[model samples]
Target: MRLTGPAGLATRAVLAAAISGMVLAGSFAIVAVMAVAGGMILSAYGSDLLGFVRITPPQMFWPIVWLLCALGATGLFVRAIVRIIRTERAAFLERTTPLSETTMAETSYIDSSAERLARQVGIATPTVRIDSTATPLAYTTYRPDTSIINADRDETPVIVLSTGLIETLSQSELSAVLAHEIGHIANDDLRLISVLLMPLIAAETLTEDEGRTSNVFELCGHHLSFIALIGVGIFSRGRELAADRAAAVMTGEPAALAGALETLDESATPKPTADLRDHARSTNAINVLPTLGPANSGTGPRSTHPSLETRLEQLRSLARG
Candidate 1:
């Protein structure tokens, strides 16, 4: 589902809850185990002062203590494993494939066009990078640079486009795509999404374990993480539509932006099974639902982009005006 507007906000809230819940649960488990171990140690050592104290054998005492400690450590480790798994899954879901280095040169040809468009929109020129990926994708990154735009010298924006996108779109549509990515930079949407997702990413990294079994608790955690990731995915889709709108406004060519969306929609072909659709929905940037044919289709609440038809209709409306 699209992650913009009210829906996006709700999804972010869910993601926050998932991350917080994992951390809290892990900590509580560790504390409980430690408390139990401490009590056992005291009893074995005859430290009770109520009335009568009983002492245990040295061999038994040492082994029990060791076992308690081992158990506590094991619990903590398992919690960490769960957290890491969730985080990785979230990151994977959000990751947009970078354009390949091979196609960077060709995609870089649009840099001049992007610069001109930025000027028209009253934003400073952003550094543009091109990737060689076959997927028609684009994203922007910000870096601290000693460059002045309207006397601000803190953060500079960099826009990256995929060569596949460049090859797929006509010149007018390419400008619209560039404008859309530039809109992301202008609105600082990229930074917001990154910050919101950092905790979940950290949690996933902490809980990852290669050899650990997927126990009931871990499996439940994974499902929560997956839901949270879906929320993030929804948020991302909304941002995409917003960017499209921004692109249309900046270029004053709604049809061009609409065309670009249609191109992307067409490229996202479906695989064979429902399982693959779920996998693609979770893992792929492009949604592969059957209804979205090359011409037009309605995007549901969960879509990252508006329906191709909806976007085209909006463009046509703008063009008519």
Candidate 2:
């Protein structure tokens, strides 16, 4: 009923390649046409309007321009991914303090538990951190290890648990939460998420949808954003399910995770304000629990994670097995 393993990987790969190819071809065509037309226009009026700046097509302009653009875009995309990870972590750190091993012995225990869970899920121990947020949430992020530069040093992912979450769940439930986060690290979902966001980032740059923009640009961005959002939703939902399965297998306690989820599910209240709703939508992709009012309530492209009911069903199935 669900796509997992090699079949799912192949499906996602094909879809991602198709979408990326379409976007690249469209961008290249647009840029090439604009460049050629601009050159022609300048050449036509240069003598009369502006004599100082000579406008002429460079030798092998098409190849040179396209090659440069391809390389620049690739480099920028990679850099953007790194910066995004750092920036998000910085923002979260700004709002809260790190967990102190000396003062908080309980958190220290949780940290050790997280390390064991990470190994169980087949990943290096992720750096464990804590946030002061009252919301019961846990999430993970990762970057490549740079200790040896060229060598792969088993980059540790980061696992963050809110203080509220720690206070809320029992020890077994906390272990389940850690297992779920370790599932994300083991899956390399942070990289997958960055890949899914690239098109939306490109769209935002072209259209400036976050700020005021011309009507035409706004319209173009709307369409592009919609497409990107749909892609993200589909891709992310699968990841959540995969992580749930991994957590279940690693902990051999899908029931514990299910109970933890149900406990958190009780905390879901109707988001009354626009800002709250927007925040929920934005974080849903990363958070262990979706914050968009209720799970499976919204339809279509807006839903980032699958419904709690759906996730619980999966967990229950694993537990039964």
Candidate 3:
């Protein structure tokens, strides 16, 4: 397979998978602990569980408190899992125009770019899509593998571009953006980000209404989500830079991407592509640019992407090389 970046897409994807596994497991463990703790605490007071091992005052007190925490965490974990299984979609998504339904207006410009770039990357052309929104946006989202397994059972990735993006960028610059997104598919980034984001989504959903009333176990799960978020952020930035390199190498036009990044940030009136209340973290993880403002955007280690200047410099370096 063709390598996409310094360590190659396979290697980077492996790292992201490993991190995702850890995050998933860690969050579950916290919930399991919460369950155990909660059971022990409940048993201590009035329940019959563990009443056989009648440990004395102070020692029993600490154990009881710990047990309650574990019990609560476990409950939250189960609820989250159930919700995920039932809902299927990890998070709410904005509507996107699918390939068959895509209008002819800008199809020539966007689809042709995607078709050409996918060929260069040796991947099947993805379903290029448009989101009917005013905000400039670009992101890759996963499609579930529902059809009977064939030799080509690969879940087709979707590249979504906002109306504002199409209106704002020149064809070359938009092509660069398309190349960058196609690079994500070439590098297996869509699945990686989706897997890495599970815990964060679970945490947010778990605490959506809890507010101050959230218990220690819930808090633990929330805190563990941060670790997952950080992991996602680091790998996300790596993939972003790698995709930049891939775009430049594939298109032989790093300046085009650099210019697109500049124009997106320098927009006279920047509109958010995702609701900060519900979807900012989700969108920011995979969007071309972090939809949230800088405070919570992918500008830092805690967010999903690197700074605009960082990405621009990467393309500049690629161009120079």
Candidate 4:
């Protein structure tokens, strides 16, 4: 689950290459814009404008300005996403009830299973919370960036479950779900996906405020972000498959996980346009069950998780073997 072997190396390479690709794409996009803009200016004003003095040591001022602008936009892009992450997480937390207030009497197995599975994998037992809302939902969260001086992130990742999920699933099925989430914790899927999400969020921001773009630098950032989003899509789906596989292995009950998935699939009838909980839509990537009907199996780079069919097929294979 932690990404080892040739598969691990390949995943690391993909991640590194994706980030590098964004940087290169941004640089090239900016350069191309500069080239086009220069050509237009030269054509319009003729050689007379060239007399304004090109090619002085300090005359590289425009280039430096462009570089600084690009850097500034990058900082802004990152900052915007950081705010978004914090806000969505806050919204999610606000809507969910803590475990202390919930029916803990019914969930003793939840703690035991989480502790045992996490310990088996040498990870700290994740903190589990309950959402009172009845819409079936489940996800894991890791706050590695929560606090630099006193972060207990690796030691205390979180798993959130809705009362709907608890009431809907049997104990064994819930254990399978817990095992699956622990797989995500062990694999560090949340943080890794968060990295991949950066460019997409930047691109999304640009789309929302497209008219605000007054320069080429911002345009370059948009282009590179869309480019990086493709890689993110590919990796996102792969992580789901990895987590599922890890869950099956860890629990030694591919069928139980499979049954849980089937139950969730049945209840997921017609994805809601607006979930009862705020920001629930945004939390899909980390959720145990996705919102849409997409059966994407990492075959399409645009998908975030494997479809139910794809996942069930794998679990069925494991069961057969």
Candidate closest to the true structure, highest lDDT: 3
lDDT of 2 by residue, 139-218 (tens): 87543233211224366656778776888888888888888877776766766675665555455545653555577546
lDDT of 4 by residue, 1-321 (tens): 263322763565387456746664665455555655665454446435554767233555455555665566556555665776665556566666667667655577887899999987888788888877666788876443463223345457678898878888988889899988888778776666656555555454445444455565567556655566566656666677777888888899999999999998787676554663345334655678765455432445555667778889999999998
Local distance difference test values of all predictions, in order: 0.54, 0.64, 0.70, 0.67
Pick by lDDT: 1 or 4, better one: 4
Clash number for each model? 20, 0, 13, 0
Q: What is the lDDT of residue 63 in candidate 2?
A: 58
Stronger candidate by TM-score (1 vs 2): 2
lDDT of 2 at 144: 29
> Relative to the unseen true structure, what is the C-alpha lDDT of residue 260 in candidate 1, on a scale of 0 to 100?
75
For all predicted structures, in order, the TM-scores are 0.57, 0.74, 0.77, 0.74
lDDT score, candidate 3, position 60:
73
**Judged by TM-score, which candidate is best?**
3
Candidate no. 1 TM-score: 0.57
Q: What is the Cα root-mean-square deviation between model 2 and the actual structure?
A: 5.1
**What tens digits encode model 3's per-residue C-alpha lDDT throughout 120-190?**
87888888777776677888775433221121336676788887788888888999999989888887766
| Candidate 4 Cα deviation (angstroms), residue 141 | 1.6
For candidate 1, the per-residue lDDT at 320 reads: 89
Pitting candidate 3 against candidate 4, the one with the higher TM-score is 3
lDDT of 1 by residue, 27-121 (tens): 44654676567657766555445225454346566557656765776677556544543443443333333333344444454767877877765
lDDT of 3: 0.70
